[model samples]
Target: MRNLRQKQASLVHRPIAWHVTHWSHDVYSQGAYSTLLPGGSPAHRAALGDCLDGRLVIAGEACNPKAPAMVHGAWDDGIRAANLAVRAGARRVIVIGAGCAGLGAARHLSAQGIDCVVLEARERIGGRTHSLQLGPVTVDVGAAWLQQFGDNAVAREAERLGVRLVGTDFSQPLAAASDGPVDGIEAAWEALRRGIDRRLPLTEGVARYLAGLAPAEARATRYAIEGNLIIEACLPLAELSVDSLDEEGVGNDDHFLPGGYRQVIDHLAAGLDIRLGQPVARIDWQGSDVRVNDALGDFCICTVPLGVLKTLQFVPELPQPQRDALAHLGMGRLEKVVLQFDRRWWPRSPTGYLRWYDTPASWVEWLDLTDAVGTPTVAGLIAADAVERQFSGRSDEEIALAARDALQAWACAVEAVR
Candidate 1:
């Protein structure tokens, strides 16, 4: 990794002094899930089981079979685990992390008149949901959008927090297939939608059938299906399980939060007693009680991210079944690069660019930010795999140059349409 960083630094044209240093250089490590099950290969489970003792209940988006790595799913899991712990007669329950799940757990407990403590690993709350000051406005560097329209918990939270929903217009002129002129972009979109629609039912049916099988059988089938879907959807289908889709129903009513999605976390964390910048080093749950040790001291949570649990060292290892389940789970990598332009350089459009490159580094989507804010900022080249790799060591200049080149190509394609 150090060699990679040095190589990245050497590749850039500008002086090393001009390059911005990433404090947390692990781009894949987005701290997105504080209380989610860690999904990976069998090896991931072996590492994860090292942290679990029987009493330390694991709950988070990752832990959820349906919504393994989404913010809302994690939140829901935390709440359910907290409720379970309370019902199990736990007197004082602590939330191990302060992401959406942790906050959700704490909020539910508080609502139920149960006192809980939230321990966060960062200085501020919200694990992966965060915003940054960009000149005059705040830009969301973490979670920027909500999926599934108004039905999802994040969307509902956005509404409750009074965050305005704005539509993304990707109607910009761009290069299209040999089908026709620039106007054919609409046709391309329609075709893509139709394609997705046709395959979606098949995928869903397969998922449902696989969901009922024995643990081993289900894991094998679901893993294959999910791997394919990740490539097709550019998202982990496990995070958008059949349950979530059924709950939302079918719709073209997706929405984005104006103040950034992080505001939802802020609203959720209000008035809650949270401890930040405390990373749990160990968890002891062999005894009747559960104990979590960070740099500060020992605390307790009804549940923790299964991934985190799997990594932490436990005095006594977890049982084989739970360990096996953890091993079967997997984590998909999704990365985003938000570029704030000095001016709105890209053409206007109702639909964003859905590029199809012959190479692995091809960006899947390019979102326009003109409607979201008056500024010229544009979030472009949102690629899952490549971005993760680039984040490892690429300098800001290298990223900027690459984005500029892509934008120039897109701009030319749009001009050809005009």
Candidate 2:
């Protein structure tokens, strides 16, 4: 357990005790789960195994390694799983969960002339990519940006669906610590470019080492460069299996869509049969045909999130290896706070503001969203742990106040620039 001071220090802004308690109460009331399991991986499938009586198969983004934790990645996996099940002669397939994965599965199955019934627990579709209206403007509470969109299926699908693509303006000026202008913003960008360049050789070297091919097979320097790229992505080059890298490297550069990412899910859900407000409570796979029970009639999907499956009681129990793998597969937590400002207060240079505070409770990075949206009414502040804590016990007023202070400081810094 972290001490109050330590916890406060970790936040982007010092949170009041009352706010913390209030946030905690809100979390409990909402039944929000803090621990995350990486969505979109095979861990769920492995855990469920052949328990689905050969009639049921699980497929979702969580089952794919390369696309783990991504919306389109999950959708692609869902489609593949549905296709596999259809080929196996399963009739009247059911898709559990109406998120991107489920919708993707439904869409693909529909295209292939397969019948699929989608069950969504929420009133609307799009799972984690949800949009909410704030003061006459609809904002994304979930996935906002498409990341690298061109290479992404969601981006392509969005384009096909007439969803507009917007490029993020990276030309905004940035402010640094203590409400000071970041003099090194340009230098930092140059250094980052150089770092990436420097890392390429290292990546290539590691790739060669794993392939067991002679350094002469590819320039040793090239292997080193590739190895460094892998490392930068948080995967160690030496430990990365060649097969895994080959599979994972399929799509690297993708674009982000404007409006909201949820549009893709909505588009996918259109024309598909979906039962909303239905949550699957249990799964009985002992029978020849798998059964899933919710408020609505029981239906089965080939795949479910490992997090959901882990809590579910399996009569025969899961295999040890599968269970262990599920346990080991970690999930990352990301929170986005969109601050609606009265006006654009930050610097307008290409390099945006990034602040590092001596205190733990200050925001680490703030980005200008003015260009993404027509108005300068919104800015995004990202502080991982602090934001998580903020969700615990703080009131909306308190959270807003803290955000205001942080933004005010940043605004001051921006104004200081000539």
Global lDDT of each model?
0.52, 0.50
| Model 2: lDDT of residue 169 | 40
Badly placed stretches (over 4 Å) of model 2 are: 1-53, 169-175, 178-254, 294-299, 302-306, 349-362, 379-384, 413-418
The per-residue C-alpha lDDT of model 1 at residue 312 equals 64
Off by more than 4 A, model 1? 1-55, 168-252, 294-309, 352-358, 381-385, 388-393
Best by TM-score: 1
Q: Any idea what lDDT model 2 has?
A: 0.50
- For every model in order, what is the number of clashing pairs? 23, 57
Q: For residues 1-418, what per-residue lDDT tens digits would candidate 1 score against the true structure?
A: 3543343344322221111223233332333332212233323322332323323556666655444455666677777676666666555666788877788878887887776777776788876667776655566765566654544676777777678887543333233311123233334333323333333444455545555556644443333232223332333443433322222111235566657766688788899989887777566665666666532212245344444555666556656766766555533344445566556655666554333222334344456665676665655443335455555566787765665555545554444446
For model 2, residues 59-120, the per-residue Cα lDDT tens digits are 55546654654666667777776766666776666777787778877887788777678877
TM-score of model number 2: 0.67
